[model samples]
Target: MEYPTIEQLHTKLINKEITVADLVAEYVDRAKASDLNAFREIFADTDIAAQVAVAEAMFQQGTATVLTGMPIALKDNILFGGHVVSGSSKMLEHYTASYDATVVAKMKEAGAVIIGRTNMDEFAMGSSTENSAYGPTKNPHDTSKVPGGSSGGSAAAVAAGLCVAAFGSDTGGSIRQPAAFTGIVGLLPTYGSVSRHGLMAMGSSLDVIGPMTHTVGDAKIFYDAFKGKDSYDGTSQEQSIAVSLKKKLAMPKFDKGGIDPEVLSNFEMIVEGLKKEGFTIDEIELPHFADALAVYYILMPAEVSSNLARLDGIRYGDRAESVSINDVYGDTRGALFGPETRRRILVGTYVLSHGYYDAYYNKAVALRATIRKELEQALETYDAILTPTTPTPAFGIGEKVNDPVSMYLSDLFTVPANIAHHPALSVPSGKSAAGLPVGVQFIGARFGEETLFALGKIVEDIR
Candidate 1:
């Protein structure tokens, strides 16, 4: 059965058409019976009863919000007090969060019932959920294909109707890519617009938490509920800009060799459709744009190495017994950290090493600033930059697992937004000939979420 959207469900609850318990019970049963492997754990009714009661009271007191009683899921990397959040890694398999993530707290304040923590790539280090310590999350569209990662579990949960909405963190396209692969909407808010406190850090400068949903409107509702300045996150700040559309969208000219023919065809069709809707499509030249993936690889892994260093066995998670402290650290990480996590750590450490810092890391840093400036300059005239979210639709599971470079390329178009600290949204453009979903992304200027939302809705409606 297709589940009601957040707003639709809200109306039903307000009209007494259904109770919160009934809704939660239905989704819980479905989640339990599913074989998608989308969730790490579904909170027992006993664990959720208090929130249900709180939501029920909010309605009774006429203080309910759109999210009240909505059964939502959080990506495993997000912290929810009293729940185990392992970041889909064996290293933290038994680790419990002592406090809530800021976004989790916001959702609770809005009377949302967080249903469970979904699976992901171990330590948010892979492009496919196959890297998860538990298991890969299969795409809801086809059991044989991957849903995309490290937010694959959350993407699958929402796509499979296991929950009304799910929250996922994006560090180099984790959220958007999976959302595209699963035929849903994903938003990557401007970096630092959403608090990162309690989110297991992968790349601190590149990470932002956002919502995955079936509709653009739902994404906006979820974003509004949680985004703002945070005392817990020094990098967080509130967005106050009022964005009005300029009716102009910029499409970058780039090599099409790597992109699937069908995907490019679908995108061209979307561009033509928008032109018919009276929006101007400008082919703009952003020279540094083509270097996004290269820059992201260097900068993100560098941040990953630094942020993940704190996860030493002694401080937080599973530890290997050894006679020496060095052996303990070495053995624990080697045994518990997945291959993708280890690979990134090694690459990160290499680039940040004293002898190579100026050669690799510093050059990438300089190039990053150039790319950001190019994007900012383009957005000064264009409302948003548009592109297909991924080069192709969901590939078969394990297809790219052994080919790490191919997997990294999965984030091609989406990484530029993170590199530039701009907001980007992925909306289902249409389905491929094989019936897989193809997503179109809109990259807006910083604090231009409203512009992206407006553009995303148009893509959603046209589809």
Candidate 2:
């Protein structure tokens, strides 16, 4: 049987149909039995029981928060105080967090039972979870295929019924692609809407933490709990901007060879379904949308190169012993970081270098602004912009891992929202003939998540 969503679980707790302890225990066992290897660590049985007891008391006192007694699995990149918070990288393999990330603190305050830490690509760097230092996470639906990453494990955990809902970080398509691959809902909130205080930095400007869940409502529950201003993160803002759904949305003016045939077919079905439900479907032109993937690659890697400089042997991560201090730096990084990470760092450094800065990094930034404006203009006329969450369903593990260009192409459809700093939600559209899941995205204007949720519910019913 499938696990109930947060809303259903809440009702069950109130009616004494299931105890909080029972629910947590059930999920913990479910995780252990899975062959997908979705978790890096499942909290100790004793530790989980103690949390369960606290939630049980919340039920008894009638003081339960929306997520009280509910089990949640966090992407490995999110910090949990006193736990090993590796970003699935050997560099930080033994490093432990001393404080909770803003999101982690909020989850605890709301009485969420954090069951474990899920795996991810090393330093949140790849389209597929294959970059994980430990091992690649397999898709829950088909073990031969990959679960999209760097949030693949969180996506798989939720898909396999191991958790009611889970948290995943989105830097490019990490969360949404995996969610699509696994047949769940993945939401990427507008930049600065959620705190970034304790998250292990990737592309600091592009990275965001959001929910992976079974339904639009379930994702909304978690999104509401975490968003707002945080004293610890200057980028976070308490957004009070209000948006109303227009019952209208826009789609890109397709370029030849833009998307996979299967995905295009499912998207057409989604458009027709929405039109039948009284939605105004328009093909709005965002001319700069064509350049988003390139823009993201330039900007994201530039940020990644800058942010990752801190992982030197001195401050944190595993250190290498060397005669010269400078050699220690080279030795530690050379031995610990993965190939994909090393590739991005090199690209980032090249673009940010003195001679190339104006030619590359500056241009990406200028174009990013233009792209954001294009999305802004579209939103004035439509509730959201729609696209396939990924070009194709999850590919077989090792299929694209050896080809970097092909791997990057997996993120083509999902990079625009990150580049534009807009919010996007991925909901399962339908499945392929081979039974693989496919997802469609709804991109909203800045701080316009509610509009996406409203339309997302309609998409869910149609699917």
Candidate 3:
């Protein structure tokens, strides 16, 4: 990696070779100069200086945590108290958070500077940041293409050197896909391993807040800081495990029908590299893989419909006046939400409706459980499972806006991990013929992030 790792920067801070104020100033300058549209705000006033001074004092007192003085970006969906958190939607565009999310509190307690919130798909419903109400975040490597949504802005921010690292919530493949598109490291930690207290809900069962950074080592530094239980979130857990790495990994038997040709070739290259490193590579059957995407679309929008209900124009966003309460609700939501958000809400409500409930929603839930069981059974025999993070590299902006089914196909490989409730990471493997980045993903058992990180370093070292 051209950029220094988090540990190296920490060493410099501890040795008095650099100061927090200086680091923040330089990063702030870089962020301002960026053309990627990565940030929603940059604390252009003295707020950044104020936060840096506190971190500077921690360094002076020799009481700094691993993240002390580090400048990091948070996805717009994450709530940082007293700041506007719109989730890139007009419904909450003018709303301000009342309190910080648990993860934000943890980062602040550790002395990390919260630079600003980055852009995302409105309500995190789209696969590309082009759906953002503000504007699409351009890929740093190639502006004509997307940086992947809904965490596109955060990934772009890190890749463009605007921040040392950034946090993005992955509902399906939001974080991992964007990281892959931008050629950075992205980790979707085990479900329940990190608190979702402050992250805006997309799919309650699927959302995860994770790191985007230049290298896997930097990702570890960020992950270790906030992966734990929080009373505010019912699903959060204090998952404890001893770190271990086996010299073997596994991949599913390929069903070449849906995968992009370049992605398959990249997967082959990764397999060859792992074999050269003396790690055994085996192909196992995951028959359920074929049905994963269909399963995800059903469950995700159902959750999306349920979670977004609280944002009534009366309580949360721009209001509409009418004598009838129904019109107030309809007009407000209809006008404020984007087309994709409305579509999902309608689909979600339809599936959860009376006659269709058992046919669609219930069946999907049952299949989801079976998928999780099959994955757990597979993990017993393999250290980790590998696949391409995204089926193709970043598509051009507006290319799939009118084609929702094709857009959803982008998450073909990633949705399975979220459905199975396992942890996964996207490591930049190689470049596509178009010179865009290609990502290979590793899915491990719950709380198996350590093994993924270890292998991710090997892949990073491949270059």
Clashes of each: 0, 0, 0
Give the range of the ten consecutive residues with the poorest summed lDDT in model 1: 1-10
**Worst ten in a row by lDDT for model 2:** 238-247
**Candidate 3 error regions (>4 Å):** none
Sort the predicted structures by TM-score, highest score first.
1, 2, 3
Q: Could you give candidate 3's per-residue lDDT for residues 1-463 as a string of tens digits? A: 2677789888999988988888877788989998889998887548888889889899888889879999999899999998899999888989899899988999889999989999999988778898898989999889999999889999999988899999999988898999999999999999999999988999999999999999999998899998999888889888755667677788988668877899889889888988899889888888887577888999999999999998777777577776688898888889889989999999999999999999999999999988898889888877789888998888998899899999998988888889998999999999989899989999998989988898899898774
Q: In candidate 1, what are the lDDT values of residues 1-463, reduced to their tens digit?
A: 3557889999999999999999988888888998999999999888878889999999999999999999999999999998999999999999999999999999999999998999999988887799999989999888999999989999999999999899999989999999999999999999999999999999888999999998999999999999999999999998756868789999998789999998899999999988988899999888888799998999888999898888778899889988698898889988998888999999999999999999889999999999999999999999999999999899998899998998999898999999999999999898888888889999999989988988998887776
Q: List the candidates' TM-scores in order.
A: 0.99, 0.98, 0.98
Clashing pairs in 1: none
Q: What is the lDDT for 128 in model 1?
A: 72
- The local distance difference test score of each candidate is 0.92, 0.90, 0.89
